[model samples]
Each structure stands twice: as structure tokens, then as C-alpha cells.
Target chain A: AQSVTQLDSQVPVFEEAPVELRCNYSSSVSVYLFWYVQYPNQGLQLLLKYLSGSTLVESINGFEAEFNKSQTSFHLRKPSVHISDTAEYFCAVSRPGGYQKVTFGTGTKLQVIP
Target chain B: EAGVAQSPRYKIIEKRQSVAFWCNPISGHATLYWYQQILGQGPKLLIQFQNNGVVDDSQLPKDRFSAERLKGVDSTLKIQPAKLEDSAVYLCASSLVDSGHNEQFFGPGTRLTVL
Candidate 1:
């Protein structure tokens, strides 16, 4: 069984300020990590995922996340945030296999204040 | 390509009343999923389907909730005796494959409000 924990429920930051959303997971086996974002009035979309090869993964947007195996963490980060960057971010985990089920965190609402 | 589609964006009904939501996955996708997202909580997987076949439904509340993917394309979820706690967003998603690395496309969830 795999579970995700996102410590922060909400985060408010000024425009152009750096931000990081913490995410930690518990699993008996190695798992894949993912970051999903949901804009207001929009459906959830996959921002980035960490399958293998690199511990660090980046989205098309400026956001990036690093998968730390030892720490069991996959924290999302952005050097600078824009107004449009304000959205709900979700951290998810799933085990690698034929039948995969993704488990998502409660989510962190990022409010980029201008 | 067209994204997933859901019907009845918002629905409100009294407790004990039945309600249903529909979903149409992206063309050619074989895997479909139903999730329930309560306010202030992340989406929880209710059931999963692979080409009209049931894959996982352990998390679903079998006593009141049921879902089906009849044609390997469209799916429907229903709550026979909806409770107040059932007031949440029902999300439908589909993926190209049933792999951990596959990306699932989500639809604009159907928000159910129980009065």
C-alpha cells in the first residue's frame, strides 16, 4: 500500500517569489511519483512525473520537482511564480505494475499575490 | 484530440435521492477510472475499468455506489441512496494504458450537492 502526505494545505506567496510544496510518501516498494495541477474551473492535468533515470523532473511550465528516495519525498519547486501560476497542486504516487492505481495527496492551494 | 467529457456539471438533490453521472473517455483510450473528491480532500479512486472489464473496485462503497463501463468507451456511476456525505465532485479519467507511467486525462468533474 502507498500513501502520500502533503504537509501544507495552503501557501501564499508574492509574485516573482520562490516557492516549494512539500510532499512525502510511504510505500513498501519503489513507486512512481507525479505532480498534478488544477486551475480554477479546469480539470486536473499532469504537470510532471518521475518514472526513472533522473531523480529530478520538470514540467513545461517553470515548476519542477525532485524525487528523493532516501527521504521518501517528492517536493515541487519554482524559482519564481506568476499570477497565472496560482492553482491547486497535487502530489501522487503509484506502484509500478500491470494494474496501477494512483493515490493523490489532499493538495496544496498556491495563491500568488500580486 | 478531444479531452474526456462528463455530463451534468452540477446537480443538487435531497438526501436519499438517487443520482447518476456519465463520462466519455478520450477516443481509443482503454483504461477508465472513477474518483470521488470531497471538499478539502484529494480525489479518491472509486473504481477502475480496462476495456469494459472491471479491474479494481475495492474502494467503492458497494452498498450505495455502483459503476459500469458497458461498451469499453462510455461509463456511468450511480448512487442509489445518496447521503449528505456523498456531496462531492465525481471525476472521471481515462488513460491510454494501465501502466504506472501512463498519463490520465481528467474531465470537468460532476459536482453533486446533497441537501
Candidate 2:
């Protein structure tokens, strides 16, 4: 079994400010990490993923996350946030084997204010 | 390419009532999943299907919750004798195959309110 922990339930930041959402996971085997964003009344959208290599993965929307093995963390970061970036963020993980189930975190709500 | 589709964006029912939700995965997708998202919480996998066969359903409440994928294309989830605690958003997601590291596409979800 695997579990994901999102340290922050909510994070508020002024427009154009940088923000980071912390996530940690526990699993007995190797895993793949991912970040997903959900806007109001919409389904989840993939932000980025860390399958292997580089340890650091980036999304086209200025979001990035680093897979830290020793720390068991995959924290999401954005250098500068906009009002449009306000949404719920989720961290997910899956085991190394093929077709393994993915487990998600409690989620962090990012509120970008003016 | 069309995204995963689910019917009845919202549903309201009384306790002990029965309700059903439908889902259509993306064409050629080999894996489909049903998840429950409680308020202020992350989505929890309720059931998973590879084609028309069950892959994982360890978290599903077999007592009152049932789901099936027919012909390996469309799927349906049903809850009998719903309870107040059953109120949550039911989400359907599809992936190429649970292989490697493919990303799953999600539907808007069916928000079920049990009174």
C-alpha cells in the first residue's frame, strides 16, 4: 500500500509571487510521481510527472516538481503565480510494476490573490 | 481526441435510494477507473478495469457499490441503498494502459448528493 501526504491544506499568495506545495509519499517499492491541477467545475489536468531520470520535471504552465528519493518528497513549485493559477493541486504516486494503481494526496488549494 | 465522458453531471437522492452513473472512456483506452472524491479530499480509487475485466477493486464497497464495463468500451457504476455518507463526486478516468507511466484523463465527475 502507498500513501501521500500534502503538508499544506491551503496556500495563499499574491499575484506574481512564488509558491510551493509540499508533498511526501510512503511506499515499499519504487514509484512514479505526478502533480495534477483542478479548476472549479472541471476535471483534473496533469501539471507534470516524474517517471525516471532528471529527478526534476517541469510543466508547460510554469509548474515544476523534483522527485527527491532520500526525502521521499515531490514538491510542486511555481516561480510566479497568476490569478488564473488559483486551483486545487494534487500529488499522486504509482508503484514501479506495470499497470499499478495510482494513489493521490489529500490535496492543496492554491489561492492566488491580487 | 475526445476526453473521458460521464453522464448526469449532478444527482440528488434520498437515503436508501438507488442511483447509477455512466462513463465512456476515450477510444482505444485500455484501462478505466472509478474514483470517489469527498469534499476537501483527494480522489480515491473505487474500482479499476482493464478492458472489460476487473483489475482492482480492493477499495470498493462491494456490499452496496457495483460497477461493470461492457464490451470494454462504456462502463456503469451503481450504488444501492445509498447512505448519507455516500455523498461525493464520482469521477471516471481513462489511460492508454496501466503500462509504463501514462497519464490518466479524468471526466468532470458526477456530483451525488444523498439527503
Report the number of the highest-DockQ candidate.
1
In the order shown, the candidates' Cα RMSDs to the true structure are 0.6, 0.8
Best by TM-score: 1
Interface RMSD of each: 0.7, 1.2
Model 1, C-alpha of A102: deviation from truth (Å): 0.3
Tens digits of per-residue lDDT, candidate 1, A69-110, equal 999999999999999999999999999998889999999999
Q: What TM-score fits each model?
A: 0.99, 0.98
Residues A1-114, model 2: lDDT tens digits: 888999899999999999999999998888999999999999998889998899999999899999999999999999999999999999999877776889999999999999
Global lDDT for candidate 1? Answer: 0.96
Give residue A48's error in model 2 in angstroms: 0.5
How many clashing pairs per prediction, in order? 0, 0
Clash pairs detected, candidate 1: none
Docking class of 1: high
Clashing pairs in 2: none
